[model samples]
Target: MAIFEKTPQTKAILDDTEKLVCTIANAQNINKHTEYILRVHRGVSKEDKWNVSHRYRDFAALHGALQAARRDLPLPPKKLLGNMHPSFIAERQIALQNYINEVLKHTILALSLNVRCFLDPSNYPANLTEQALQTVSIALRGEGRYELKGPLPEIGWRIRKHYFMVTDTESHANCLLCWQSYGPDRHLCDKDLQTAFKCLQNLSHPHIDQILAIHNLETGAYVVRKVHETGTLRDMIYGTEYSKSYLSKYGNPKTRKPLTDGQIAHYGLQLLQALKFLHDKGLPHGHIHPGNIAIENQKVLLLDIENTLLGVANVHRPYIREHRKTSSAEAIDVYSFGRTLYEMALAETLEEPYCDIFPCNMSNDLVSVLRLCLSSSSCKHGMPTIESLLRHPLFSRPLVMGNGVHSDGATSLRVPSQLKEEIKMAVAVMEARLKAEQKLVRGAKREVRIQEILGSEEEMRKQKRRAKKRESVWKSTSSLAETVRSQSVSTASSPTPPHHTSDAPACTNGSSSTSASSAPLASPVAAGGTQQTKVTNEAPATNGRSALLSAICSFDKTRLSRINSE
Candidate 1:
């Protein structure tokens, strides 16, 4: 007897969907109610744009509940006492923007059952929305998990509710990092994902922040990474480093404790090792600075290297790009590392364009290392290599270690304890002297303030031309340095060496002049090409023309006109 068996209906698999990005369009006050106008979209296209409005109080309540529910997540601090003040309101608005970023990051990290319910207001009981808006105690409900079939079942993370422990379904603990992903277009996102995964997968080091997983959704993918609690090295040096607007709202501390000489040495050695490894594998770190370094467990870790492949330019500051353009890819790493070393050694921030003389009162050995590293000319065969940095005297027990006696016909390189102690004391004295000098500089800050007031478009254009001329002078100096390096290399190869000062010609006051040695000149030969020609410092004819150019470069038309009228 054949019996007709009823088949069970199965739920359809959820398709991968595009990530939703929320940007604050405006915030307005209406009848004492603060309304946030947020624009949401999947990608750059305007087809699926959604503009949603919510009361400021709703965000405050959401923040409160999120704090209570997910202690693991770090949300921007909420302002309670002075919410109506203009300054406080402005600050809160920026914080709210940052809060949206954090929320989106968290949602992208793990889209579990609870996360879906938290995001979709429709899933909430009609009364729950009202309750959530009213009570700070009400937290979102649902667990975070992969909606589609995967290798593991229910391995996900989510914000906790009433119970501190996640329910029986959750298989993974709450993660510390809030991952962010973007898809300008579906095809582009896929292409970027594949490229990023391919590049990042081969990189594995103790100092590098490793990619744990790359989770793909229908329209985008999440690149999950781990971050330390100590935060970025930039945060350690400066009180905080964020967007300019964010910084203006919440003033960062002007100064922070600089890493000690011993600490810097330790960090440098490890980082140098990582650089050598990367370079050997034919991968340029692309970015290397204190800001990109992460400190965790008293160790130095590299962060944000994967962004280069994601189409996120490593152009943090304009000058960084300009400087990097002047050198090869691997050399950029060395050049940036040198700047980072200078900052760490001095325990202060550097104003760029590559200062030849540092403000810090450090040992000459330290200074020499910095000079070589800063010079773009040093990236060649004759310059100090990353491997050579491992054996630098600065990393030795003493800053200056004299020749040691031979041991079994070989020299003893080990430093004595007494010598090490003396070097430490010497560094400490120099640091104290620098701190005193810095105090004086800080005291005269108000007197040094000279704000330029540009009144007309013509004046603005003149100022721009002067700025361009100034940039041209610096570029000439870089070319001069490279030329000197090439000459030195060629001279070294010859049997008889001629007397040549390796002192790099400096561009001061927007004009370049060599002392005893002739510096190379970089003049515009074509729209994009610069012709390098040798120029002597003592040449009267060249000096006359240079002086004329300098006069034009330094002239402030508006100021001169006002002075003439007076």
Candidate 2:
């Protein structure tokens, strides 16, 4: 009555799981126009790949064609206005991409579309067909030029849509039991499953249900997820027959509702953290209703991320309609989350004209946060960022694992003791590593400064040697000039008496006049020599002090820079 018996179908399902492969390789804008080129790869084989470009109008036309082709099928809503805006166009492109993704994900849609167009690209419009063929031709030419080729990589967890149920194993662990049903359309379930798979990846949290594995059968696909035993928040508030009745244990005496101020805070924190994680990754979980939320063991888990605008292939949903139709995807998620907080606080599903329901038993802090979330204004003013929401005073209270009011009189999230401890331990380890890194950086700076000092000392020594060589050359040149001046003065002053008596007197007079003029020149030469002597004596000391001071100043400045940087 519990676990399913191992059968031939089970093995076949597991084997086929390996064969199912689908990946989105690239989404390129075509010709700088409203169209986008999509590269879809199926399985690991080269033959399974195909490329196609689709514009916004093209997607609308495809939807219209599908509707005309089948009156029974439900199509997602189409944009009637604001298509010209860049942001709107980008979001619509993603929606179209997700729609195509969903089409390929389901067997019925895949077969229908395959017959309609995908089987042969030429079946599309002439321009689109030409574009596809040209893309193929370009790829073929590139492949031919390659001297070698090998098999391509496998696609991502090749998951198709399937129906699933939560069941407890003998080990007391909860497992998601999924199987394909050919009964009804079940496209909505497939939509949810694909939304979960495609939107969030490599994300983990106690409050988040993570995809564990996928099993594909000849008839349908199966998805397995890690979950808690306590069931979902919906099951807790209401009741479930699958496990020990949570209602009997945790429900209130009067209202029979287990969720109170403490429980709301706990769930709110976890849900906010999950939302923050998604928003940080640029993913908005368009669907945040109560049923999509699960409570595993004691932790509140956020389920179904794939229902984002693009995740559902544009399927119309009540939650999307309830929230204002805005171009801001993140804002839509925020408003939905606010609505969820309002419901959690009230312990009931919120209906139209949702008024402020702050009961006397509810804490004021919790009520305030809910008010901010439920505000009708724009996100910038009414809704704070996810980061700011996590910091609300409600979470400031000491968190106790598995419920009960905190010592600070505030009810806070206490999903698990182990998770909180792990986070604290991680923080401690990071802090220690950061300190060690800072110390290493300081030491490296010190080493660099010491090297600079040594380099500056060597430079100062070179300056001193050059200064000494210049001073010696100046002294030798001054000495040679002084000796030549003395010899010239002595030759000019001599008598030269034995010529003619008349010429001798004239020569003596000319010699006397020349000596007089030379005497005045000698005074300037003496003054120049005195100035040169003074400069020669003081220049070395002055130049050396200035050079040494400059070197020291530069070295100190470099050392200071290193210190400041460290």
Candidate 3:
């Protein structure tokens, strides 16, 4: 009577689940943009798949699965989840009650104590385990309490938009932990998720995928993520077009080599910098691959964190019979990361130059570290840390080396006296990071205090929250009204891209065609490869007259050096 037998509706739901979960290239999402499916349309289309029936059935099955594990594992505490917001706790209670009343007849106390959990992807702690996910309780809306559900597995589901991913009940219990123990941190759950989704949100390293806002409502919490268009990196590099272009850019021009030593070093360094940023934060992406690396608007993004492993073994839910030993579990991630690097690099070079002709592109010297990892004996050298790989002899070298600084030699990415300024900027970045972290800790602590106090007095808390939410809505409405009012004032403002006047030409030669634009356009190099970056072109013509574009096409490398050294 519990688990579903063969039914058209159930089968349909299962099919949708498979499609969403198994789809290649593109990561999927709950199509909340679409109208909610009514009872009749519930399994009719893919868009209708996330309806009430689907959640109910999924939760039921999850609970059944977790109950089987409860005999052996005790549920972990709430702090293991992450920053949960008090408003979220209250909101979920209100939402859950409304949603459940329509389907199940259960009292709050009889079912689950109203608890909110926060699961942190930050530093992914190992204290939480598979058993921890099993038999956790979920809050029943009617009674404002929790009942045993299933384990919160990090498997497919997300909660509160960016907290713990549980396939079972403990995730439910963990949600409560935020409500009960750390009130303020819990309150931030919504904000944390929301802030993460906001664009140009340069908090995480450039690569790591971001979390947006967590929407906790009547039914469940929805973890929000960004919309990716170009699909995953795995599908990209493996495809024919991406591979070819990648090679042409990085490969030798004459031999059409797959990649030059310089190019390998450059791309490898980029990956290293990205990884270092994550690892230093104690966030080692357990699943680093081209597939997880997404490209949005030409920006590289590391996606899929639910499987991301941190410093510990207990954080990830294992599908296969995994080595429960923490060391082995953690070590496995490094190898996986290494292999993924190899796969991406290999795919990037799987072209003609790389395979046969180009000696440079196919050189074994390329990404020696990744090549070592790909060899049958991955991590054979006592599993060198990512830190070590970053500092490896090969990785530390410059991308496109020419000659040495001391000797009578040439160089690339010129070094000059002005480099002192860049150093200052880099130092400032470090100081800013420390200050930001301190502020975050203080803020989270303050919220925790407010939540604890508010949590104790429920009826009063409810009234205040309502007033606040309503106030927010009013403010939003008022802002919109103000925008409408300002629509008249917009006549004073002009909207246009700043274009050059007649005297100033877009190209040095003033040619309209950018494709045929002079060599100086590619770089500020002079005609004879001298760095003359400051070589200003002749003044633009005052009259509506044309001039030869050849003058604009000139470059001076010596000028470039002076600008750098300045």
Which of the numbered candidates is closest to the native, going by highest TM-score? 1
Candidate 1 regions exceeding 4 Å error are 1-172, 176-203, 215-221, 239-251, 315-317, 375-385, 396-566
Give a tens-digit lDDT track for model 2, residues 216-291.
2323443446544565565556554223322222222123254666767777777776777665554456557565
Q: What TM-score number comes out for model 2? A: 0.34
Clashes of each: 6, 8, 68
What overall lDDT, based on C-alpha atoms, would model 3 receive against the true structure? 0.35
**1 or 2: which has the higher lDDT?**
1
C-alpha RMSD between model 1 and the true structure: 33.5
- Which lDDT values do the candidates have, in the order given? 0.48, 0.46, 0.35
- Candidates ranked by lDDT, best first? 1, 2, 3
**What lDDT score goes with residue 413 in model 1?**
21
TM-score of 3: 0.29
Residue-level lDDT tens digits of model 1 in 1-566: 01343211221112113345777887777787567787776422347566767676676566554442333444456556766677766776777778777766643232333333333444323342233222211221211331211111121121111011122224453322222222111112333335446556555667777655444333223443442445477667655532222122112245666767666777776677677766564444656877678877666678655433322223222233224233344455666777788778765545454657764667676677787776544533233667777678766654222222111221112223443343334334433432343344344343344332334666889999999999999999999999999999987875432233354233455432332122211112111121111222344774755643443333322332222535
Number of the top candidate by lDDT?
Answer: 1
Model 1: weakest 10-residue lDDT segment is 155-164
